[model samples]
Target: MGDYFIKALACGDSLRVITTVTTETVREAQTRHRTWPTATAALGRTLTATMMMAAQQKGDEKITVTIQGGGPIGAIVADANTSGQVRGYVTNPEVHFDLNAQGKLDVARAVGNAGFLSVVKDLGLRENFTGRVPIISGELGDDFTYYFARSEQVPSAVGVGVLVNPDESVKAAGGFIIQVLPGADDAVIEKLENRLKEIPPISKLIDAGHSPEQLLDDLFADHDYRVLQKHSAEFYCDCSKEKFGDSIAGLGTKEIQAMIDEDGGAEVTCQFCETHYQFTADELKALMH
Candidate 1:
């Protein structure tokens, strides 16, 4: 209802599916970024896809997805943890365009298709896992699907969508990822491909009040499936003034003194949430020591 995701195993455990509804989460992002309709759709789709990808990890694991399509919307970045906390922002949030030929938001127009989609995974290891693929459609869903097939070598179908209201606010946002497992047969894969074509757009389904379980049912079509887990999703940023101060301190005493003498204060704004953190002259002085 609010914002949640489910992990499920379907088709006799030969397929893995993750479905999520992200309307409220995307609304929060739109409000924080003041994104236009087209920009909202682009960023919302990226955030939804990033959350679903992170859901595949374990505790404390994280995923960062970045898309640079050389479009009017500029770069899109999203970070998500296994716990379902996600935060993201677009470099240009005021972009908008007329609907595409399909009578839907022109996401590809805003996102462009001249760049790349990259994913970085932090698994609490010395080196993070990084995968990148060329941007296919700039519609986000197909781009991510390509990432799985090319980068991860897992045949996957990704369906992500976002619908904005007349007032430029998020009306609905959601997505699903269906992956063919090791044991899946060609018949199962072919059936899934056909079914994906028949189902409505994910945003439409979410707007029509389709739950995650119901979404899986629609994909599976009477096939048996088991729900593995349910997790609530949210837009959360862990930035703080203290953390920013620590970063500034790492700049060393000379830089701190320069800020104290030249500006008397410093204001740092987070890219993800746009929250401003201020440090007074005295605070900078303390960091200098």
Candidate 2:
């Protein structure tokens, strides 16, 4: 199935939920960064969570999520907009580790336990909104849940998972976010919590051929959830050769001349999607004029 995300309301509008299937997205990331199993899990989880958060915005608003954990994987950054576009990268993508004690990918070790998860929302205002919280757990899902409760002051549950193949490719990747809005009764919260604990991991559910709507049904069970909207999600990058060329032009005349004298040419590569742009000597000369 194509990558997609869904938003729904349950418990009489007292709860908001988002879910996404991102297997293809994660695969594209792995191919671009050549990430190992552990790195794939870490980056994939962050991308999945960012996509869900972006769905909360309106119009051209966008959200950028940055996880700077002092671990082998370095920093993980992802940006997603209301249009369902997402792009991200890891500072160090070659990091890998054996399964943890639970026989699961060792994401905590790859991401470390000390750091911060910061979200910056560009709402087309003079000052954008920003929220930050300490990383309570390097597993990512718990860290995001903590962000919601502490930073946003909303009780929420986030489940993100990525399964890597034996050859270090992505097998399955997806996630879900369920938040309790104001006036949520204790009984409703308890039922939702219980269901969350009983349900399988999000990645496993997607691998088992479950759709985003079905995942919500499993989370809400007998409760009625009204689907609000659905949108296709993918690993999309907005970088282009023309944009890089403009950046080169902005480097000023002196820097452009230095490039001609030293390197004979210039090459720019985007770290987000790994797209490379090369400028030959003739191209550089034209820019100099």
TM-scores, in order shown?
A: 0.98, 0.97
Residue-level lDDT tens digits of model 2 in 1-289: 5899999999888899998899999999999999999999999999999999998889999999999878889999999998777889999999998899999999999998788999999999999999988887799999999999999999999999999999988999999999998889999999898898899888889889888888888888885789999999999999998888888888888999899889989989998999889998788777763
Top candidate on TM-score is: 1
Instruction: For candidate 2, list the clashing residue pairs, or say none.
Output: none
Residue range 1-289, candidate 1, lDDT tens digits: 4799999998889999999999999999999999999999999999999999999999899999999999999999999999989999999999999888999999999999999999999999999999999999999999999999999999999999999999988989999999999979888888888888898999999899888877887888885799999999999999998999889999999988889889998999999999998889988888875
At residue 264, give the lDDT of candidate 1: 92
Q: What TM-score quantifies how close candidate 1 is to the native fold? A: 0.98
Clashing pairs in 1: none
Q: Which ranges in model 2 have alpha carbons more than 4 Å from their true place?
A: none
Q: Which 10-residue span in candidate 1 carries the lowest summed lDDT?
A: 214-223
